[model samples]
Target: MTLPPIRFTADEAWALAAALAAADACAPYAGAARTAYQKIAASMTGPVSVAARELAARIVALPSRTDAAVRAAVEEALTGNKALRLSSVDAEGRESDRVVEPAGLLTADGRWYLIAWCRTRRAGRGFRLDRITAAAPTGERAQPHDLAGLLLGSVAAGAARPVALAALAPPS
Candidate 1:
């Protein structure tokens, strides 16, 4: 018996291309689908596709992962599902106390951003990892929130905001 060739629509093809291009392990399949991938990539115009492509470029350009301290903080918060007390300075040079339930960590444009549920603002906020002077586990489990929703909300809320590192601060 012979099987019929499978066919994919433009949307499906585009999704497959993006997935393959975003992963190093899929390089072989990506090479095989080069032509289709290019065509789909070039034709991408939807908001989601455009955002995804832009993010993919940034991820590719990142020099390295977040620093060891930031990585450790994020790991502890995520693993324990706990709130992180962050010592951070805002753009206006105001030092603030922020307790957040970390939702996710993302690297874009050679920087790390932490998406979290801010207890102070009573809303979701994204903080630049470099700007965080210190992060300590609160030892209190976080109140559950929809992490995927928070991340998607961050994208809609403009993930390009300029947040800077605290000047003259020691690592915590």
Candidate 2:
């Protein structure tokens, strides 16, 4: 059976662009998403379309700064619901190895961060992509955790929340 065309807003498009751009496997999906964004923008009225087109262009043009191999491993951990072994350096330049349950990836300010429940600290942590020296799938299934809850309640110091697509809405 043929499916009806799906409708998505500019905000959703921007969110998807931000999420996909941080991944190593962004090439194929980015192209398709851009085409879809253009189509959606065409269907929108007035400034929304203009804003969407501009945002689409900017988001697509922004280069990913996350290390490819590390991004891949974290992505795998998330997709496979497996734990991730991470070797990362703290701000003070101390390196530590830890296992974490990959919850989500946040990209902001041209940087990527892996949000996870840390086994080392027994708490949630947002490991910056640049700080991660290595990432590998641990093959062990991750413990169940709610991402929204983790984001809201964690003691992740200086954890400025990731923006929602609705926050990117064009001025009213």
Candidate 3:
């Protein structure tokens, strides 16, 4: 037997699309919202059904939680000038130690990332919060570093240049 066709008005379709995008944005960070996204996907029947399903799948694949101890340590470090000793695993599966001056914590795509000045590496590094097994205060004060410059430099390198509105306008 064939299923009945589902229909939506143009406005309704636009509203659904916006809702789906919102759900996608929240799903990575919020467990309850991820469940809501699944429910929304279930209700979708026609044109937007595939898009909803894809968004739901993407949300399901994201990491759900950050370690409590690691999070607390990072938060504490953010409030002070002390350096932290972070025990983390590398991409190669080998564990390593890093003494970092905590600059900030950023959440992207449902995961927490630590942007810090790594004294060991002599540069800034972004470490995934989940991978940090342990965080301890070093008691020693952090040296002055250009945290904003490092973060902005990394973003500028890959970001697309902005276009001027006049360039897009046609002369009368």
If scored against the real structure, what TM-score would every candidate get? 0.50, 0.59, 0.52
* lDDT per residue as tens, model 1, 59-104: 4422333344655676689768999998887678788888999876
Question: Considering summed lDDT, which 10 consecutive residues are worst modelled in model 3?
Answer: 156-165
Evaluated with TM-score, which candidate comes out highest? 2
lDDT of 2 by residue, 1-172 (tens): 4346555576765665455544333221334454654555556665655665566566534454556687668767888899999999989999999999988766556556778899989887889887888999989999877555567755444454445554774542
Which candidate's lDDT is highest?
Answer: 2
Candidate 1 regions off by >4 Å? 1-67, 156-172
Ranking by lDDT: 2, 3, 1
Comparison by TM-score, 1 against 2, better one: 2
TM-score of model number 2? 0.59
Pairwise lDDT winner, candidates 2 and 3: 2
Q: Which stretches of candidate 3 lie above 4 Å from their native place?
A: 1-64, 152-172
Candidate 2 runs further than 4 Å off = 1-63, 152-172
